[model samples]
Target: MHSKFKFFLFALTLYFPFTVWSHTPSDSISTEQDITPVLINAYFSQQPILGLTSSAQTINTRFLEAQQTTTLLPAVNTVAGVRMEERSPGSYRLAMRGSLIRSPFGIRNAKIYIDDLPLTDAGGNTYLNLLDPAGIHAIHIIKGPDGSLYGANSGGVINIQPEGFDVSQNQTSLLLSGGSFGLFQEQLSIQRKVDNNYNFSVDQSFTRSDGYRDNTKLHKKTLQTAHRWQYTPKNDLRFFALYSNLGYRTPGGLTRDQMEENPRMSRPAAGPNPSAKAQQAGIYNKTFYGGITHRAQLHPKLSHTVSIFGSNTDFENPFITNYEYRKENNLGLRTYFSYENIDHPQVKWQMQLGFEGQKGWYKIDNYDNEQGVSTDPQAKDNLDNIQHSFFYRAMINLYTRWTIEGSIGLNQSKIAYNHRFPEITNASGRINFGGIWMPRIATSYRVHKRLALRGSVSKGYSPPTIAEVRPSNQTINSELKAETGTNYEIGGRIETANRRLIVDLSMYHYQMDNGIVQQRNDRAEDYYRNAGEIKQQGIETSVWTYVLVPNRQRFIQALNVHSSASYNHYRFGNYEVAEQDFSGNKVTAVPDWVWTNTVLMSFPKQFGLNLSHNFTSAMPLNDENSVFSEKFHLLQAKGTWMWSLKNKRQLQIFAGIDNLLNERYSLGNDINAFGNRFFNPAPTRNYYGGMKIVL
Candidate 1:
């Protein structure tokens, strides 16, 4: 039924406009008008957004830029329950909601995207390694579960939207910078619309650095291209593509003494060991990912998008040990369209339908003593895995402010083995249904023109990922179930008399049943099982006010302070570990309190400064305090200046320092790469500068 309906819509849209009166060319708008709106669609929703169900919990781009953060992690870290980690500046890992240890193989939790195209790898890790944060125009994190819309991995979702094009203006921007740890970055982007209907956009970026430790170094490059064709007054078609390559080296983790005394040290071994064997000391890796996306406007306010993406990742352990991974491949396809035809004054309705699928395989090989050794026999049944999935979702909007969303999915996955292991089979996979209903009803009585009381409640659920189903060893033993939860939040937004005071407060109570947790198996003793009931309740608040407002002639215009705070209580259910009675044990890594405050001083036409302070409560690095991670505060600052000559030319300067205090702090447990070290060494202190030109 859905397929037939989709076809009908397509046919109707293809017919010449002789019979369609509602279709209007987007270009009909005055060409002199600013194109910022079309390029950044999500921003139109200023206050608590209610339109795009994808990001009911809004975090505007301006709010992020205010922090002077260069990556997605820093900008998103302040959101309650969302934690992002970086072993160094080159690697980033993120987890949303409860601190659950997702599987390390094949698409784990969390669905990620770069400009509507999936960025998730087979191992469930997002390919943030290749991204240059400066290229992003806006990002919206749906917070909580989004499995209903995007199939598989429900740990919460992040949607990134890039800049589009302008039909009336030919614009270009460039930025270059050098920072601590031998880091250097460059970015260039250009977009222009020709005539009144065709537009082109291009972007390129490169980054390289010596890194913070004994073996941390990274190099990356990216190129992006996009074309928009307004076929007619009523129809538009767009094409976009991205190419990214990344290379990095990591010095293995060290013991407690090695971490505290000399934070810049590394083990260089392939596995956990204190020995100085050069074979296992460090590792080098290279990865590449690229994809294409297409979007078409079928009718007024109705559009469809389709994308195809793939990646190849390779890594080698240059340590004394000859462990290595030659390559892993992933391919994905996605399609979705939304219809927003709420043109009626008395009643309104909107509908959204989407489907997504990913197919991929991974290989891990044991190498001979030599560097690039390969054995023909061992490569046959090779350590390989395939993950395939499909989902169907629908969201209906009744009236302007009410929404209900639901989705069901089919998942089939397996790990391949040689004939040597007849005991290993791939029939244990299972299918599941997951999604959320975020019904937001905000009645703005309007206290004058800028303030109102806004309240909302949202329910979210995340399903287990492909890796969780098939651990390192695949079998039929107790298959784990997806952890399902709800995020109930109530919040109010305030806009003051002078329009300079912006305040937001929100309280959330989260609960999960049969959540996926790591538990010591009673039978195997050392092996682990997935089982648990968990709860996390927290409150988040933010205040952004302007201490100074600049005038047209002054250029030094606004001084704003933004602060947010959160307190979360996380604990296990009636469960025990190591035969110890442990009913009230706190989960590892999920801190009890976290907060961040940023002050931004902006000069409309000249320069700007941003300073931020962040704090995280002491968290048990391991289950016991023996490996406790102490709490610490980190400070950062950045400045930007713009210069212009006369017509058609402009230059912008940017510089910043991260870890300005050089505060040594651990980013908390992410993947437990270093089993026992409570803290992962942060960079000492580094400063960087860059310049951008627009033509």
Candidate 2:
């Protein structure tokens, strides 16, 4: 493995070699001075990554739109090492610093995006309920691997940007919601700027939720429309069209004594009691996505951007003893070019060169006759597969504080089955390189101006996917190869110059070689091989800030505290699971200890108050299992009010309570919080309310 990844980078350059450094974020305001907004939403001097840095207690989208919660895994489980693993109610799954939270798939190692693209499915599943935060304006999380854009099995990356229309014409909004399982939601929006160079917006959303269990269920529909045109002063043309139709119902998995006796039970029980009935292990799916981007400026350092994104996925199931129907079709194309120069004084340049390609054509069908019939078979799409990839990148600007970035890529993929599953036709290729150095003398000044006793050392990479190479009604051997990973991060972050006492931290030591695990085959007990030599190391910390300064509540002006927290540690070297004895052990649904805490108090406006909490420590139910669940916590709260009836326009009313101490957790499928738990129950203390309008 390349002389053990170059002797593990020669033992982290003999232990942190003064933690590297190099700059370009305009010397980052002369070395950090209390800057918040979650490091301006995870670094953005117009997008591009390398040795990236972010902290101000991370978690900012106005602190996740202050509890407008519908996704983002429950406002990022309220920070502090994060946690959210529900499999019902607007679908959920995401866990980092602890690695794929013990895998039940979906939310695959973190990789979700709306603007920066990527919405994974086919291998790296991502289900944040297909995203819909009513045109969210910002949210950027690079998290792991210093976030060099994306590639491979992305360890973590969730960038979303919406809400644009500069000129700001009459601006409009409307929202209505109904509560308690059988819940309903609606949102409508409009923003304009015609002529003055042009800008536009049109939005839509529909939501539904029911049953705390039984077969937990939900429904969603969303559409986004955008347009921006400016031709003249440097040319610009941007247009985006998005459509999302999500259908749900997949409540299955549990056995650790039925998730500890009943974390809201469900099986065929008509999935989440909507009058209970069905439950033959039902499954439903529908998805569609679209994209477009173009920006141009021939002069001034040269500029260019071109994009094309596409998705078409469909799945419908009645059960599955082998298969009934499952489909996937995807297409992606991207092109880019940018170069901004600073004629050398301290040397300034922000360069980007790009090209990306993705294609997936999936299938599954076998009710051709009978086995576990549902009596309605007349479908044929025997299945066909195809995969592809292409990439190129760069970053450089040495001297004046120093900075360097690198990229060399080639990922060719192929899978064929023109007819008789041609032994599952397969073809592959791999090549990757990563680099980052911000070493212009590791900073010794500005430890107080908002903190920066400075330090850095970064390098990250990921590659390997195609449903991990032929998996779904399995049988292997088509020459599999490609599962490369490498990451080494030394971190530091803390800021508060009027951004409220903030603190952010990082500590990593990762190493991976020929790592593509899932080896065990008593003649097919879970196949998809490329095994051995897998060792994992971890430690990630986060603590958010903003204790008070929110508008005062109506008549009781006194109660304000907004907080966030985190802590995680994990390990496993030789590896082993399900046949127990954990070999080197320490990996069985991840949780050596994880944490989450959120507290917000308000009452000076008539409505506006919140208190939330989350924590995870003992986890390990199967794979010989450590079996020590029963140490989960969750509590929630919210309130809001504002009004001005008649002609003028304005009205708001809100209320909340979710798991308000109804503490019951289930991540992956640990079989705990219920009778045997494998997920279900993360909603016991439930209460909701809403009302809104402004014109």
Off by over 4 Å in 2: 1-85, 88-91, 95-99, 102-153, 156-180, 191-193, 202-232, 235-255, 258-301, 304-581, 584-678, 681-695
The CA lDDT of each predicted structure is: 0.54, 0.51
Give one clash count per candidate, in the order shown.
Answer: 23, 46
The residue-level lDDT of candidate 1 at 145 comes to 52
Q: Tens digits of per-residue lDDT for model 2 on 1-695?
A: 25565355334323321100111111111123233343334322543122243222234434454564465565766544445665676656676554443243355556566664566643445655666776666566655543344544435566666665343555677778777777788888786777788887787888878657766567778888777788778877666666677766656655555556775665422232221124244445666776767677887887877767777767655432333465777777666677778887666656565655566676655352132345543333333333333444454554533345444444344444332333333322221222222111112123354554334333333333444444433443355554444555555555566655555556555554444444333211234444333455555555444433333332433232334444434444554444544445454456665544454444533344545455567766533454655666554556656565676566777767666555566655532122333444455556777776767
- Per-residue lDDT value at 576 in model 1: 55
* lDDT (Cα, tens digit) per residue for candidate 1, span 590-689: 7788776666565555566666666778776544434667686666667766676578577667677777656667653433334443345777667877
Error of 2 at 41 (Å): 20
RMSD of each: 12.0, 26.1
